[model samples]
Target chain A: MTSLAGLIDRLEDAVAHRTPLEKEHVQAVFFLFPLMFFIVGFILMPVLGTLYDAFMRDVIFLEKEFIFFTNFRYLFSDPGFWNAVRFTLLFVLISVPLELAIGLMIALVMNETIPMRGLLRACVLIPWAIPAAVSGRVFELIYNYSYGAANWLLRVLHITTEPVNWLGSEIGAFIAVVAADAWKTTPFAAIILLAGLSAISEDLYNQARIDRAGFMTRFFKITLPLLKPVLVVTLLFRTIQALRVFDVIYVLTGGGPGGATEAVSNFAYKYFTAGDFGYGSAASVLLFVIALLLSLFYVKASRFGEA
Target chain B: MRGPDLHTIRRRVSGRLLILLCLPMLFACGRGDAETDLVFAVGGAPSELAAWEKVVRKFEADSGISVRLLRQPANSQQQLQGLMVAMKSKQQNPDVFLMDVAWVGLFSAAGWLVPLDNLDRTPFFGELLNRTDVYDGRLMAAPVYLDGGILYYRTDLLEKAGMTRPPETWRELAESAKKVQEQMRPENPGFFGFVWQGAQYEGLVVNFLEFAGASGGIQLQDETGGVRVALKANLKALRFMRDLIWEYEISPPSTYTEMQEEEVRTFFQSGNAMYERNWPYAWTLHQSDGSPVKGKVGIAPLPAPEGEKGVSTLGGYHIGVSKYSDRKADAKKFAAYVTSKEAQRMVVLELGWNPGRGDLYEDEALLERYPHFGEFKDIFRKARPRPVIPYYIQVSNVLQTYISGALARNRSPESALEHAQIEIDSLEQRYGRNPEGGGGQLSESFPYPSFTHGEAVP
Candidate 1:
């Protein structure tokens, strides 16, 4: 009877010990549940579904059939697909660095103790704040062949007698796209790099000044190296975003002049809009793979820079 | 380690957060299944939408059926995308909608449209009804309006050049344009000989078809949907189109890059072009009070190739009931009322639109209002439609690229058509109903491409 009573007492003690601990764990899980649900439901599931769809003949009005790698095979053979890839890659290679360079310059300008700095920052963000579609239309007007600002300026400056066909020729369209994209995205890069720029210790700069380091010397030695990590992150972010570009191109060019300016995402969207989901999914999956590889490369390079 | 009050507050906060997170899902799932009002979707310029709204109100008053007017974007492609989204998910709203004629093939094949067996299709243009709305031996939609490409010539410019009438052929048009452009250029530097839809969009395809002319024009071969774009007639048409931009220097360089119907019309209306190729709707706008060429504009059938008869491309909107619609009866009632002769007459009178109904063209009242209606009757009858296949959008996307490339002088006409043929062959193989029957080679005939689920393919 005494032993049985002792066992009952021990059981009560165990319950007392475990209840709060278990409660805490359960509460923690509850806190995380919403985030996990969103991640799984929206992002992970659609990505997996798209991956699965890439292997199927998922066209409208047709029986959905598993046609493994066939869509990808077709994509590889498609010249339009290759053109899109070439355009996207070239765009990234040119525009990303151009944005970073311009952004860094803007960040440095904003970092200085200049008058109306806050107002200047806000004004700079206006282009970035506007939706891409709206800004694309604005750029469309700016680049209009006949009476647009682009031509008006060129004529005023005596750059050419005739209006340069901005969205007509292949190279002209390419430059227009890059310039428009750079204008829209450079502010985002500037804001991020400004954060990095500010994070630098004032003491280091003071020491550099004491050591009589010139502006160029200080910028090369201190600013650039310190800004490297942030630059890599910004590069990865911009590259992924640029690879999936659709809205600006859709509004500005409609992938025109014989589709000289069509991006991979725009190409995929065409298929999706056409109800050829399998081919569209395959295109998206290829783009996704490209982005994944590029991000991975950026990650490795960042880690190397950190070391 | 927290006190009981703190723990309770944390739990309450988390509970509220969870509810907040679930709120969107709850609202998203709150679809009204017992909806009685028929949702009729139509898109156009604001004025056009307002006219449609009036039609819907009249439809409600006439049929005692309530319809919810769902306004769509003015851009046709954006409207198609929105409709595609709803149809893809099999949504019950948007019970009825206006479909671009080209989309009829895609929508019908996808089984998104309810077959209108009871619709009195005799009222609509018979050939158009068959070309655009019929699929699998059933009428899938009813026409709402008819649009066809026509030539808009500057009468004053022609009169100034001492040309009594508009050019009858491409050669004659060019000769007249060159003669007038030379005379007019010193005074008006912006003036050009011709303006057309040379931009890389659907209009380019329509213009190309018109240029190909009625004889041996580029068309879908059959239900199998094979197309021979590299045919001799198509080649000649493409070369002439390119020469107008680069060789003859008649059409502006921007024509290949920027011109669509609106751009072409505005350019011509602004007195920059001697001749313009555009749809019939532009006639009213060109003749509006403020237009520079208001009184000087004249209409004619689009000029054909030297030997072939000129034919405009068939374009219009068709209204159909959705297969997924819960209110199919109401939807059909509204559709019928909208396409009825009375409503068509209202559309013509109120909006200055071309009526889809065949009988409206014969109406004495409409004839008095729009004398061009007589000319339009002939153009509408002779109009050739774009390829009527499920994959036409995809096919157009391919052709838009190659043809625009050719016009931009990036490649020769021969190479452009050859490559386009190759690309289209593969598109057929991928999306064609019978892959084995329709791939690689451009053929003259293919049995109508029909979709049957899981029966044929291995």
Candidate 2:
């Protein structure tokens, strides 16, 4: 016990001899240690564990054996895996642009000097505020074949003689899911872009107007160029999110109509739930690689932070 | 030195604060005393769960053992997934599992379940008890309730169509449904001839099994040495199901999208269809006060193919004790209690569950309360179980995919079954050989005892 007390005294003397600023730096690091430990333990460890599992052959009720690269090789050959990849790309390609365009439009409108601007901005966020699962259910009800509001409006408008099965066909289900996702996420993108819009000086717009610039010209020149950084960030985030879409499609179609809407995440989720951890982990690793590559491309293309 | 300055004091205090902050986590890391409370994972409708709560209360009072109920997801597939995760992790809290009938082979082969070979089986129906509980000459689970697929038709519509009884064959049923549809269309313009679960899910597998059984077809035929996929019977069943939608135009195209039993029930209960193939639960729902077809529905055996006996797919929950359970004795007692005739009677009287025991079906009071209980008992005795193999989930998933593909016109029934057979064969090769004595070998066909139908009650 006396030796332990002497060891503590020596540690204190070593710390006391350092400069006050350095001592403060040491204390700051000590404060962050617990948080760093949490991230490493919970998040990083599980990620590494998944990566390690990807190299094995594991199925429930069977012994796990190390078969490096075999899972990936099998996945590459599986038709279902390729189908999921194709649909995931299609979903991301369609939803991201639609979300960006609508989000920018809403953000521009909210940037205007209008009455009840705060209320309007808050109201625009309501759809985004609803949980994705709940919104998926709402969309499910709205797209019901017999009693949905979509068919009701169409009939009231005399658009068709019969109610359309919005969620029963492949193309119809795809379009319906994408529309639901876009509706749920556009407001979030709008809020982000709105912050960017607020950051731009009002004087710049005034100068553009004085220079005889029209609305479209000023938006193209000033607004677009200034919002590029924020837009790129939003695109990167949404692209990653859209690539991993599961809940809405699951609640909406369950990847049905002959697996037309099966995303990569859904495929991996199915395998994972079926206790094929090795293959599921392999699929997830591939997804992570794709997401990482896309993020790198965005950062390189935008080049926003360099300056 | 300024006699241990403020900087030294601040550093020591900060270090003490950090240690204090971690104290709760340290305490949390300590494992508590050996758990005495038994956890049972169960899934059912809200009303059924409420009735189960009363039964549990009684058991707790009688045994002095505390029980915690872990409600599982309503979807069967999701519930199985949850159980698999828990069992794979070897969780000791959930001492008992309310498993689906199809899960017996999978859970037992995984070594997640405790063998209940010593339990008395005399009170239960011989066939029902044997088919769901036994796996590879050992009992792994006990029957808690019995559910079988039955045909429900609009009694008033059948009467209007000059049919005094339900159809006895598939062709006759289609003709009757068409006649009823033709008569009822003017009054209810959106009327459909027939509706059932045709989606790509576990329900679709059950639906197909009934059809295949009635046609004297089997998907997996367990022979003396190995298992073989019955491709021809499966193809025929798929063709018949597809024809019901496209060739006959009796069922709607929307059948491909229906995911749960509730969807078909909703359509039938709304008075939109003349015939619906569903379980006995729909009978109670149909007779409920809010239903449009209240007291207008009749239950009957599903129509068989010509010259064949009609068979329903056996469906229900089974109770099993988890191998990882700490309180095995208490868990076993609870399992036995739930399957006991007394508790089963309460289940039937209060929750409308068909009792697992055969004698309870003959009880005068139960028959009086649920007039259709006798019919259900007969259906239960005749119902055939799905393939009892450890790889049943994989087999069912393949069938659901291919059968729905055929129904959706994406592939011909021959091609779909061909693909399904290949997939199932691979599964059998991987898991069916019973390596390591996991007891997954399908070495013989299930012994299905035949029982003569009793006289119908007036």
Which prediction has the highest TM-score against the true structure? 1
- Per-model TM-score, in order, reads 0.90, 0.88
Candidate 2 off by > 4 Å: A1-18, A304-307, B1-22, B31-34, B60-66, B221-230, B422-458
Tens digit per residue, CA lDDT, model 2, B209-231: 88887877753555543334444
When candidate 2 is compared with the true two-chain complex, its DockQ is 0.32
lDDT of each: 0.84, 0.80
TM-score of chain A of each: 0.90, 0.91
lDDT of 1 by residue, A74-152 (tens): 8998889999999999999999999999999999999999999999999999999999999899999998886689889
Candidate 2: pairs in clash: none
TM-score of 1: 0.90
| lDDT at residue B382 of model 2 (Cα atoms) | 78
